[model samples]
Each structure stands twice: as structure tokens, then as C-alpha cells.
Target: MNVTIVGGGVAGTLTANYLATRLRDEVRRKEIEITLISDRDKLLYEPGLLYLIFNRLEEKDILRDLKILLDPGVKFVFKRADKIDLENREIRLGDEKLSYDYLVIATGSRIVPEEIPGLTKTGHWFYNLDGAVRLRDEIAKFKGGKIVVSVMGVPHKCPVAPIEVTFLLHDFLKIHGIRKSSEIIYTYPINRVFLMESVSELVQNLFTEKGIETRTFFNPIEVDAEKREVLTLEGERERFDLLISIPPHKGSKVIIDSGISDDGWVPTDRYTLKVKGHDNAFAIGDTTDLPVSKAGSVAHFQAEVVAENISAEIKGLPPTARYFGKAMCFIETSFNEATYIWFDYETQPKFVKPNKFTHWMKIAYNRMFWLTARGVL
Candidate 1:
């Protein structure tokens, strides 16, 4: 049996490692083959990008070669998947096709700054390596002005990142002796600062304490780069000397091109982690249409379920694993303090007060994330 996995992000990498370990005997006997396809050669520690913008972590600390991270039992292919032909159970890469007995789609999400008018030119973001490096330079040169941190759309990866960056920016400005002159305006599309009521309440109180300004029900329709203004759907024009935006996000284009989903997100069974209507195929991480946070932790949790179920089926056992929408995120409240929240589908999110201990724990995880990706933690 040939098990093929697409993408090389957290979900793909962890699932591959878990399956390799679980099916080691099959792999050694050449009864089963595992392959992972990725366009990039390096595995980026995505969560560290937030710290990268603040110059807290360098590029070297967050990137690892894919060869070192993958298990010896799994084969790695460095190529861009052009299309996923679900009908034929094959993935098309340029001129070649790779067939699979079972497939896992973990293609992940991408930021579409071009989706918003003038956003690519007028705004800065920290969602990717290039954006983070550019934003790091922008933040370093900032002397203090009105900075707008706006959430342009929902269902974006790392739902708490905008808030985290706002908190971190406040401390960054203060440390630079410019907090008094700078104004931090945070905007979200909904009436609340966050989707979760509990998290919103906690974040609102924190924002008030820190003197950060917030604008709710704010959705940007266009950015006037020449005028340095954000035109919103609500008919309000918000001016900013520096614009920091969380642009819109979408799932892999290969999935969309394959007619799997209109928006690139694969229709997936929330519990079984299977691609809807296909028992032999599964979807995880940011590529799935599940309502969980598109954070790496969610991908990590889902990988366990996918790996187990696939391994059981290959072993001719009953595949009974299910995912319960478990997700966790660490919210950095300041340069030295942070808090975290964890929840499953049935539970409401609850967070403790930010403290130095939790802050260090987050820092430790940032460095230890490689182990998690390798399924070692």
C-alpha cells in the first residue's frame, strides 16, 4: 500500500512521522510505502514569525531542513503539486503523476494580500517569512505614530495573532521610549474584540489597561496608499501612519483547482478527519474546513487521529480514531508575560492571567516546536 501525503507544514510533517513509526514493520518489509510532497525544502516554525517581526527570534532559530525532520521510512519529494486528481487518486506534479492507495491533504493555508485593494503596497504583515522580515525592518525604523493593526478577514490562521502582535507592539514602543507618542488602534470585523466571549472579555480589559484603542465592526474595503487611509465597508475612513494588517487567508490552490472545495478548504469530517465522502482520503490542518483554529496546535492534535486511523486500516484493524476539535494558543500580552487558552468542541475557552512563567513556557515551546513537528513531543 502506498500512502501519499501532500504539503510539508506542521500537519503533514507530524502525520508522516507518526505513520512511519506506527507502520515501521510494514515499511521495512516493503509492504507499505509512505511519501511526502512539498514545494519548499525547509520547514518553517510558523509561530515564531510573530517573534521574528519583533526581532526576538532570528531566521536560523525557526527554520529546519525537511530531510532532518522527516523519518527515514518516509520518502520526501520536493515539487509543487499542480493538481489533486481525486477521481484517479493521483497528484499531478508538472509532468509526473504520483498515485496513492490512501491520501492525506495537509496543504495548509496562504495569505492573499492581493485580495484586498492596495493592501499589498500600503500595509505590512507578519504572517510569512518575507512579510515578517520586512515588518521587522518597518518596526525598527518606526519612531512613533498612529499604527493600525486591523483584521481584514476571518478564518485566518492563528486567530489570536493580531491581538498578540498588538500587545507586543505596545511593549516594543514603550521600550523604544515612544509609547507616549504612538497610538495603537486595533480593529476587528465583529462587534467583539475576539470571537470567543471569554477571550474577548479578557482581551478587552487588557487593552483598556494598556491604553490601546480598538474599533469594532470595522471591515476594510480598500486601502488608499497615497492618502494613508483604510476605507471600510461601514463607510468610515480610518487613517494610519503605519498599517499592520492581517490579510485574508485561503486554503491550497491545488485543492481548489481539483474541485475539492470552492475556497480551497476541503470538506472534512470533523471527528474522523476524513475528506467528506471519501473514506480513503483525509484532510487536516489549515486545509480543512473544520471550524477549529487554524493554528499548528490544532494540526498537531488532528495529525494523531489521522495517523492512527490510517495505520489501523493498513493493518486490517478497525480504524476508530476521532478528533474532538482540540486546539490551544498562547497569547503574548507583553514582551515578558503571556497567557494561553485550550478548548475542545464541547468546552469553552478559559485563560489564566498573564504571567512570566507562562511567558517562558511559550518561549521554550518556540524552540521545542521542532520536536512536536517530528512527533517526538
Candidate 2:
């Protein structure tokens, strides 16, 4: 059976690995083949992008080539996935197409800063590898400006990234001896500072303690680079000397183009990670509109569920595993300290106090993630 996974990101990669161990048992190894399709050759370690902005980590340190990451049981097609033909159960490329007995959509999402006026010219984003590199360089040259870290919309990748950026900027500026002149400001679309009320209140208190200014309910309508101002749809103007903006994010173009997305995100069952209206198709990770934070931890959690379901499907059994929207991530408060938060749909996020051990744990997790990609962790 040809099991095709359309994405080389965390979700697709993990699912493929899980299938390799399950379906590629010594006797059935010859019967099942896992094919992964993606445009990129390397998987960028997204969580480390924050460290990139501080010029502490190199691009190569965080990226793993698909060739090195994939198992021998998986065949990787290093090309763009152009289309998904639902009627024929095939995925299309420019000159070739692959028919799948089972398909998984984990193509992930893309940032569209250009969707907002003048945003590309006025701000630096740290979501993608290229953007992180650019932001790192830009942050270095900044000379005591009103650095505004703002979010364009919700359901963005790593929901806490903008907040983390704001925290890092405080330390970055202080280290450069410019904290006195540089004002760190943060803005979000909603009145609440974060998705959870308790976490939001705690974060707000921390921001207040640090003297970081906050502006809520400011969705970007336009960016004026020359005047260093951001105009909101509510006709509110927020001035900034340096803008580090998180632009509007949407699901991958291929997913949207294939008519499988509800406004750029594939709608999925919150508990099962199963795509709606499809019998053999499932989705995981940032590609799905799962109402969970679009972070790698969430993606990994979904992959575990999808992998179990795929194994059951291959064996003609019913799905026995389900996802519970579990997510936990280490919040890097400073160079020396980090905080870890763990939560699920039923549990409120519980965080460990920021300390050196948590920082080391996050670093250790980053290393383990690469091993996990190879099915060794």
C-alpha cells in the first residue's frame, strides 16, 4: 500500500516515522511504503527562531535535511505538492502524480505580511527562518527606538511567540545599554493579552513589572514605514520607531488552492484529528483549524494520534487513539531562565517557575526533537 504524507514538517515527519515502525514490521515491510512530499529539503526547527533573533544560533544549527531525517522505510519526494485530486485519490505534481491508499495533509501554514498594507517595508517578522535571520540582523542595528512587537491576527503559529519576542527585546536592549532610550511595546488584536485569562493576567502583570507598554484590540490595517506608525482598522494609531510585527498567517497555499480549506485552514475534528468529509484522509499540525495553538508541540501531539489511526486503518481496524489538544512549551524569559507550561483541553496551563533548569530542559528538548525525527527518541 502506498501511504502518502503531504508535508515534510514536524507533523508529516513524525507520522511517517510512526508508520514505519508499525506497518514496516519485518513481515509486512514489503507490503507498505511511506512516501513524504515536500518542497524543502530541510526541516527548520521553529522554536529556535527566537534564539536566532538574538544572533545566538546559526541557521544550520536548527535545520535538518530531509535526507538525514527520514527513515529507510519512507521515500521522500522533494518537490512541490501541486494538487490533491480527491476524486481519484491522487496527489499531483508538475509531471508526476502519486496515488495513495491513505493520505495525510500536514502541509502547514504560511505568513502573509503582504496582506496588510506597507507591512513588508515597515516590520521584521521572526516566524520563518528567512524572516528570523533578517530580524536578527535588523535587531542588531537598532539604535534605541520604540520597538513595537505586534500581532496581526489570532490562530498564528506558536501563539506565545510575540510575547516571547517582547520579553527578549527587553533583555536584548538592556544588554546593548539602550533600554533607557528604547521602549518595548506590545499589541494584539484582542482585548485579552492571551488566549487564557489566568495566563494573560499573569503575563500582563509581568509586562507591567518590566515596564513594557501594552496596547490591546489593535489589528493592523496599514503600516506607515516613513512615519513609523501602525494604523488599526479601529482608526487607532500606534507609533513605533522599530516594528517587529507578526503578520497574518494562513494555511499552506496548496491546501487552500485545493479547496480543502475553510479560509486557509483545514477544518478537523478537535479530538480525532480527522479531516471532515473524508474517509481515508486525516490532518494534523498547523494545517488544521483545531482551535489549539499552532505550535510544534501541538503538531507532535496530533501526529501521535494520526499515526495510531493510520496504523488501525492499514490493518482494517477502527481508530482507537484520540487527541486531547495537549500542548506544552518552554517560555524563554531570558538567557538564563525559561518556564515550561503543560496543558490540555480539560486542564488549565500549569507552569514551572522560570529557572536555569527549565532553560536546559528546553535545549535538551531541541536536541531530542532531531533524534525523534529519526525515530530514535
Candidate 3:
């Protein structure tokens, strides 16, 4: 049987590794073959990019060769997955085809900043590596002014990121002796700062303690580059010297174009992780429209469930494994202090208090990610 996975990102790579390790004999004996397809040769550790702006990590340190994920029985194809002919059980690479007995769509999500008028032209962000580097330069040059860190849309990956960025900026500016002169504002469409009630309360207190202003229900409609202001749907205007935006995001082009996704994200059974209406197919990570935060930890949890289900099927057993819709995220408060949150569909996020050791755990995660890809940790 040929089990093909699309994408080499966190979702795809981890799923491949878990399955390979789980079905060692099946893969080794050629009873099942695992093939992973990637559009890029390198995997960017996105969570580490935030630290890049503060000089905690270098560019090379945040990226890893995708080739390192491949073991003896696993194969990788470096090509753009243009489409999937689900009816024919084949994936189309331009005009070529790769047949598959089981498929995992882990193409992930993408940011579409240009969707908002002048967003790309006026605002800056640290969501990507290049953006982090560019923003670092701009931030270092900023002596004093209003800095706005905002969420342009809902359901973005890691809802706490903008909050994290603001806290880090406060510390960074204080270190440079510009904290008093600078105004830090955080805005989002929702009234709360985070999904978890307790976590939201914690973040609200943190915002107040750090002297960062919070603005809610500011549903952004457009960004005015020349005017240095954001116009909201409610006719309110917020101005800033530098705008750090969490732009609009959607699923990948292939997932959208393949017609598997409704509005760029495919729907899946929350517990089973199976793509709705497709018994032999599943979608994981940011590519699936699940009622959970789209973070790497969520992807990691989803991958384990998907791999387990596939392994069960190969062994002529039913899929007993289930996903609980729970995920954990570490919020970087400053250079050496951090906190974490854990939430699921049933429970409110009740996190541990912020401390130094939790911060180090986050730092260690940057390296542990590689071990996971290499199938050792």
C-alpha cells in the first residue's frame, strides 16, 4: 500500500515520522510505503521567529533541512502538489500523478495581508522569517512613537502571539531606554485577549502591568498607508507610528484549488481527524477547519491521532485512537520569563503561573522540534 502525505511542514513531517516508527515492519518489508511531498526543501520553525526580532535566535538556527526527516523506508518528493484527484486516488503534480492508498493533507495555512487595503504597504509583522528580520531593523531604529500590535481577523494561529509580541517589545524598548516615550497598544476584534477565560484574565492583567493599552471590537476594514491609520468597519480610526499587524490568513492554494476546502479550509471530524465524507483521507494542522487554535502543538497532537488511525487500518483493526481537541502554547513574556496555557473543547484554559523554567522549556522546544522530525524525541 502506498501512503502519501502532502506537505513537509509540521503536520506532514511529524505525521510521516510517527507512522514510520509505528509501522516499522510494514514499511521495512515493503507492505506499506510512506511518501511525503514538499514544495520547499527547508522547514522554518515559525514559533522561533518571534525570538529572532529580539536576537534570541539567528536565521540559520530556526530552519532545518527537510531531508533530515526521511528514514530508511520513507521517501520524499520535492514538488508542488497542485491538485488531488480524490475520485481517482491520485495527487497531481502539474500533469504527473502519484497514486495513494491513503492520503494526508497537511498543506497548512497562509497569510494574505494584501486582502486588506494597504496592509502590506503600511504595516509590518513578525509572522514570517523575513518579516521578523525587517521588523527588527525598523524597531531598532524607532526612538519613540505609537506602536500598534493588532489581530486583523479571528481564528488566527496562536491567539496569544500579538500579546507576546507587545510584552517583548515593552522589555526591548525599556532596555533601549525608550519605554516611557513609546506607546504600546494591542487591538483585536474580540473583547477578550485569549480563548481561555482564565488566560484572558491573566493577559489583561499583564497588559495593564506592562502599561500596554488594549482596544477591543476594532474590526479592521482597511489600512491607510499614507495616513498611518486603520479604519474599522464601525467607522473608528486608530493611528500608529508603526503598525505590527496579524494579517488575514487562509489555507493553501492547492487545498483551495483542489476543491477539498470550503473557503480555503477543509472540514474534518474533530475526534477522528478524518476529512468529512472521505474515509481514506484526513487533513491535519492549519489546513483543517477544526474548532481549535491553529498552533504547532495542535498539529503535533493531531498528527499523532492521524498516524495511529492509519496504523490501525493497516493492521486490519478499527481506529480506536481519538483527538481531544486540546493544545498547549507557551507565551513568551520577556527574554527569560514565560508562561503557558492549555485548553480543550470542554475546559477553560487554566495555565500555570509565569516563571523562568517554563521560559527555558520553550527555548528547548526549538531544538526538540528537530529531534521529533528525526524520529528520536
Highest lDDT against the true fold, candidate: 1
Candidate 1 RMSD to the correct structure: 0.7
Worst 10 residues of 1 by lDDT: 366-375
Candidate 3 off by > 4 Å: none
When 2 and 3 are scored with lDDT, the better candidate is: 3
| lDDT digits (tens) for residues 1-377 of candidate 3 | 98999988888989998989888999878899999999988988888878888787889888988887666667889999999877788999987999999999999888888888988898998888778899888887999999999899977866778888989999999999999999998988877876566877888998999899988888888999999999898788999999999988888899778888666788899999888988899999998899898898898889999999999999999889999988988998887799988878887777778899999998898878788776666
Q: Ranking under lDDT, best-scoring first?
A: 1, 3, 2
- Candidate closest to the true structure, highest TM-score: 1
- Total backbone clashes of candidate 1, pairs 3 or more residues apart or in separate chains: 0
Query: What's model 2's TM-score?
Result: 0.97
RMSD of each: 0.7, 1.4, 1.2
In lDDT terms, how accurate is model 1? 0.95
lDDT (10s digit) by residue, model 2, range 1-377: 77899999988998888888777782154777789999998998898898888987788879989888888788889999998876689899988988998888999988999998999997889999888888888899989978889999887999887888888789888899999998988998999788888678868977898799998988999999898899999888888888898899989888877888656688788887777877788888899987788988888888888888888877889988999989987787777778878888888987766789998888788678898776666
For model 3, give the RMSD to the true fold.
Answer: 1.2
List runs of model 1 lying over 4 Å from the truth.
none
Compute each candidate's TM-score over C-alphas. 0.99, 0.97, 0.97
